[model samples]
Target: MTMDWCPGIREACAHWQNATMLQHTFDALQMALESDSDASIDAVKGLVECICRVIIDQLDDPTSPLKPKDEASITEWVSAAIRVLGRGDVRDRKFADLIKHHNGLAESLRVLRNDAGPFSHGKDGFIQALTIYHRRAAILAADALVTFLYKAYLDSQLDPISSREPWERFAEGNALIDAHVGLVVDDDDSTTLRFILPSGDELPINIEVSRLLYQLDREAYVEALNAARGAQKPAQVREQGEH
Candidate 1:
């Protein structure tokens, strides 16, 4: 059943942009960047920090799904930035470099998620534990994106006269399909270990990967939880009817 569950995490991540809390942060970041009266690059850094903080906060919630809509939130901000900063302002070489770095980070996150195994069978408890592991992995990727974006903004501030049109187009195209498809051999190995074992005389061969098992256990949990909740709901309805 765990194998059957499609990871809806991507969708959940996309939803934050529409959420009030995250939308306000994006608005503030946009306003700060648009008011470009100062040469200080701190505004750019502030934007990166705000984005990273929102994502980290969302990920901290164990029940949250990773939704593509959550990603759309960031993309929406990027689109708005293009309008405010102007296409040329974002297309500079420095901005290109920054986009490259953030793209790599986004790829890394995909790799880690792919390797983490599915949560179809895994219940909320198992997912909660896995969430702990994922946050550690996500932090590195998030940091790289934030730092690169800040630096790019700083570079733009220094060379406001530079041409950014080419790079802006390039970054927009890159962001769309920029994905990490790393070969997760370790995950494959874990699968083999889970389903296969070596046998020898006078020796016990047991393949154990606790994390994988924990994830599998979640499927068992979700099913039971759903069943229990379903049972309780009917009883509640009956009591209400009697009253």
Candidate 2:
């Protein structure tokens, strides 16, 4: 079967991983240090919202038995799905902290503006609070994703205790799902297993043999990854309107 959703998943993950919460925290701190700017507030709010949405979506179980196709928006879908999972009580703490921090900053900004007072100290305090809050939020989000994926994998398998660290297996599963590289072929099936590459092109080959050679030589997989990167760069550049 064609893995049509793999690209979308990869895009979402890439977006999530590209902007570390720490980086945003630093940016917020810098803006606070310079002056309380609208841009800094927006940046902090945006990061919190993005991480929340990502965690909520992953926890909602897209591959669930009751996966709804008619989710109108990520926010709505996450709101609805998170309810079913009963994750709100545990999940709400970090979210509430983020909200509180934002509200406090807004109030401080208002007070400073009204009083004609220097906003640097107040803004700096908000920045410090936001940094701690964002770090906690990021850790929570990552743990939620990893745990949710682990639980789903365990539920699907016959042996629930196959391994203690299911997150590692989950990571392996994701790579397999993306690269379409690994498969467990039955001895009864005489025909060779063929994995369709990501581009919907290229001849299929046995990934086991590829791995064996890769382990022995190390150069092959490096070359392959490099080639894949090389091939993708120009397309990305072109998409960005670069010459």
Candidate 3:
């Protein structure tokens, strides 16, 4: 079935190994279309959270200390995915502000789900009835937010450099050394190439020194060595020796 609110959502998510979440979202959307109840609104909220979780799982670094907790809110999940997908673009102040706006929208959706969705909590008094218009608005908002984030995720996948962390990008650029050594950047901003010895001990080398020693081109290697030794030219070195 075609999802009119978010065109191409099915195709975009077709490659995912687990389709249960997407199926549930589709069912929820269908329910919303046929009913004018808060139950449908609750389902729309679930759809948004599902999409956010999927994006975060696919894009976030598994080993990062800052990974979101399992109990994170929908807004927190959205923010995590945004941080990954918006990496290269977040440097722009305007783009960063726009991301903040998107986070606000996610928070608003969460608020709507909590306040108006009957399935979320028991109410003491009579609540306002939601019309088909309310269902449509919820679907529209959820669809737009999910679609935007999914597009950004897909775009990041297409660009390898932008998708990788800083150290990974450096490793990818230096093909020869990348395979032989692991790149690491310390908290103090110092970069090192770590080589594992036969005894399994790590031998750390400064990045610049490693580059000079293992440069692929012979001429470039010589030039780097000469530059390190504070020599302008081979002739100048010989002349200085006479003095």
Candidate 4:
């Protein structure tokens, strides 16, 4: 039931002074979840709207043709954010298609919010109330969209040098190293060294503990090991003397 992306989203919003608003919205959502009310649906929609507006306002590129108007819909804001983060790269068909799909999803969420959200519109007739399952679905969708857009925004802020991995930067600095190498750290803490190919593919090799050790400064590594042993010797001697 936890929003795993809340911390990162709060961190991102901190710069814009939207942390208080985000917290209030989250608190309202939590209350709705506990009450099992349709207000959870409204909160989900409001959360997305809030994040989309933040992104549209802060990350909009003036030169980009995809920029949204001053009074744009939630879907338009989402699309504008995506376009700005993606650099309006229409050349990448895969990226274009993905953006299209995401924009559609945003639009669908907007429609759902209007139709199912109790507080969105006043109606004389009785409306069908959304169950916990619907709330969960909406929450998951909003989480995915907001997380993806925010991550893209953060990545777009990185410079070329900062975007490259450390070893890639080292390789770029070294004239003798003809190949560009990158490192990927897995969730389980295992490391893989990848040779980045010209076609953008990678040849990955799992780095063992011994190999990783040798990758560091050999002299410093040995000195640290000796220092550890030297320190342990005093403890061992003290134990024997005490015995």
Candidate 5:
């Protein structure tokens, strides 16, 4: 059975960059930020439009377990993909929440794309402001879906290989234990553990490792996804300043 799938989802959101991330609209945002380059704004606009147009494209990405299919509505594609990747595995409803929450994010992305498209070519300062806001909004929405894909990838790996197809990349996980003991607990009572491999993958504790770990180790595994890890971790700031 899946051992606390909610932790994986939390890890995916907290440490999203550790996964194979999508730069979706950031490449365009970078161009918009450049003041001197004549090609920057146009490039940004082009990239933003591409993201807008591809909302319903195939979810057959390397990070996705979905097989190639006819282009589907983004919600339809995600629903199918999640169902295949252990829709009933979680007892806590965390995975179900993510599936439901994604539609809102997709709508946000579409709105940003439509609202920002025209301003991308405008020279007026206020237009640039709207363009920047909308484009960034697009990125924020797209980022949620990107993180969910990573979470889904993790979930797919947890399922029995015989039930999954070969093209889904359902194979053995390669996480090697680099440290036998690691722990970090936050104020919210969530724990983080370092199950790093030599290849730099800080994976959550899968079932196999759970068998080998001591009770304390297993508890550490339970908390591993509560917060970010390493330099990607956010710094805590006080009321008026950073700590």
Candidate 6:
């Protein structure tokens, strides 16, 4: 079955291994995420390449500005893509910080040029962590670009970023949700398992595994959390009254 909505795109994973997968297309990449590994890097690279094509499709004229032969122009276009997402006005507040982050993300993409090193093979802890950082940046960057460029296409469908957060935490929170919920297959039911998204959409979920997603749906978890907090308030009041 074709998955309608996959929360795996913005998954929040503390460790790298939990966020990597060999996805079919960047369009399809939202369905699965783990971390950046040597094995998974090629897939993500392809995914980003697909997103680049989408960017072209999104543009009004879709020519010049980003020349394949020019790294400088490519970086400029990437900078512009990072801006005006309702994140910042570029001339207004957050300008300085935005440039800093924009530069950082662009610099991180530089590592994609090379596939050999401790970062690529995972020998050094620090470099490996840096590579993971860069890869995730690429993922989020591509995802955000898609969100901005293809707003009409994305809005009509159930896509990545199911839940929303504050603007400042948007990127981090979006990435975090990817790992929060996952599909858990039922061994007894080899034929099917009912997995419904909060939006009431359903899908096959896997190749052989008929599954009920194991993790808590975001809405349910939030409701349960609020209830637990509310439950505590009454207990605290009762103790205060007794005192």
Ranking under TM-score, best-scoring first? Answer: 3, 4, 5, 6, 2, 1
Instruction: List the global CA lDDT of all models.
Output: 0.40, 0.42, 0.65, 0.66, 0.42, 0.41
State the TM-score for model 2: 0.29
TM-scores for all candidates?
0.25, 0.29, 0.56, 0.54, 0.36, 0.33
Which portions of model 3 show Cα errors greater than 4 Å? 8-17, 87-89, 122-126, 158-243
Clashing pairs in 4: none
Each prediction's Cα RMSD? Answer: 23.2, 15.7, 17.6, 12.5, 18.4, 19.2
The runs of at least 3 residues in candidate 5 whose Cα sits more than 4 Å from the true structure, single-residue gaps closed, are: 1-71, 87-91, 118-131, 158-243
- Residue 83 error, candidate 2, Å: 2.7
lDDT of 5 by residue, 92-194 (tens): 7876676677766665554444444445435343343444444444444554555555555554444333322233233333222224333333344234344
Model 4: runs farther than 4 Å from truth? 1-19, 62-71, 124-127, 158-243
lDDT of 1 by residue, 2-64 (tens): 101112221222334455543554444344335421111222223333544443332223364
Note the residue pairs that clash in candidate 2: none
Clash totals, every prediction:
27, 0, 0, 0, 1, 17
Better structure of 1 and 5 per lDDT: 5
lDDT of 4 by residue, 117-159 (tens): 7676765214486666776777667767777777777555533
Model 5 residue 88 CA deviation in Å? 6.6
